[model samples]
Target: MYKILKKQKWSDTIYSNWIEAPFVAKAAQPGQFIILITNQKGERIPLTIADSNAKEGWVQIVYQVVGASTLELSLMNEGDSLYAFVGPLGIPSEVENFGGKVLIIGGGIGIAPIHPIAKKLKELGNYVVSIIGARTKDLIIMEDKMREASNELHIATDDGTYGQKGFVTNIMDDILKKESEAIKDIWAIGPPIMMKMCTRVANEHNKQIWVSLNSIMVDGTGMCGACRVSVGGKTKFACVDGPEFRGNLVNFDEMMLRQKQYCDQEREALMLLEEKIRRQASNG
Candidate 1:
């Protein structure tokens, strides 16, 4: 069992956890992920290794409580032990000096995994521009860290609650217009729709683009076949082959539809839980 060394609530439903997994931490690399099981009967969930201190034997993971399992995970506190923790899975992000300005784009909770990539890119002597956005200001996370890793940081909100009044792509367009020649590559992580938009923008400017995909991953290893995604007209597993892929060749629409297959059931579960809580409160 791996212990939860610490936990911090980042936003209303987002959390940062420091887990004690010395072996996993020592082997972790940027862009890799871990599969964790909260309890004996719980389903395994894959989460990116946001940061790690190998020497300290701790791995940090940031997650949003978006589903039943994630919500249960949020209820865990410091000193709690996880049933199973296995990892450092998935291919690491390709890090090198590509000799041109790079733009890193992340939307909502996707910023959690993009942080390490942006940090490594800047360290390699490339000018990194970061763009992050959410529905509103309160939902935006890791702003300070992203800013420190970037030469320029642009923020946006769907509701105009902070920074620019539109999507991150709006600011991206403005930046591309002025620095199109200087930008050599773009890396984006987010909801499928957001990634699709970023890929489209990059394609318009003929810039090389990379995207990290989060599909249904049952096991961190490729054997499960749960995280398979279509890329370049071929089958690729997101767990082993990549959480990262060339954005231009990915089939975002198909992935998006696949992700939504259980949306209605998920919504019903949440509603039922809320009703149960209400009944308990009323009885009290």
Candidate 2:
């Protein structure tokens, strides 16, 4: 059993946890993920590695209480033990200089995964510029952390609640226009729609972005066909091949459809869990 060393509730739905998984923490890189099982009855779920400390024997994971398994996980507290924690899986992000500066684009929870990437890139002698966004200011996350990781940090919100009133892409365009010569690599991780849009913008400027497909993963292994994605007209599994890929070569339209394939089933599972919790509370 993997022990939960610490847990912090970021909001009503989002939580950050540090689990005692020394091996996984030692092997984890910027873009790799972990598969977590809440209990024997719980389904497997993939979560990005938000942070890690190999020497300290801990790996951090930031997750939102989005579905049934996550709701179940949220009920647990610090010092609780997890049924299973398998990882430092998937390909790590390329953390080279890229001959110049690089751009890091993270949206909502995407910022969690991007935080380590930003820190790594900066450590590797690359000037890191990051832009993070959410629907509104209250939804913005990791502002202080990203700021520390990046040489320059920018924020955007759909509403004018925080940094910029427009989307992150707006600032992306402005930066690329001004420093197209210095910026050679881009990493964008977020909701599918946001990634698709960022990819489109990058392509227009004759550039490509690396995007993480963590949202589509199920088994966190090639055995599950659920995470199949088309990249450069070839079949690829997001788990074994990558949770990160060249955004320009990916077929986001098909990916978007595949993401919704199990919505009804997932909704049903969540409802059942909620009802069960209610019954337990009433019984108590």
- Model number with the top lDDT: 2
Pairs that collide, model 1: none
Off by over 4 Å in 1: 264-284
Residue-level lDDT tens digits of model 2 in 172-209: 99998888778989999898999999998898888878
Model 2 weakest 10-residue run by lDDT: 214-223
Give the distance in Å from residue 273's predicted Cα in candidate 1 to where it truly belongs.
5.2
- Clashes found in each candidate (C-alpha, N, C closer than 3 A): 0, 0
lDDT of 1 at 123: 96
> Model 1 over residues 1-284: C-alpha lDDT tens digits?
58999999989998999999999999988788998999987888889888888999999999998877787789899999999999899999998898978999989988888888899999999999999999899989999999998999999999999989889888888899899999878888888899999899888888778999889888768887878889999999999999899999999988888888789887876677667768988999
The deviation in Å at residue 173 for candidate 2 is 1.2
Taking all chains together, each candidate's TM-score versus the true structure is 0.94, 0.97
CA shift at 129, candidate 1, in angstroms?
1.0
Q: In model 2, which regions exceed 4 Å deviation? A: none
- Residue-pair clash count for candidate 2: 0
Every model: Cα RMSD to truth: 1.9, 1.2
Model 1 scores worst on lDDT over the 10 consecutive residues at: 268-277
Give the candidate number with the greatest TM-score.
Answer: 2
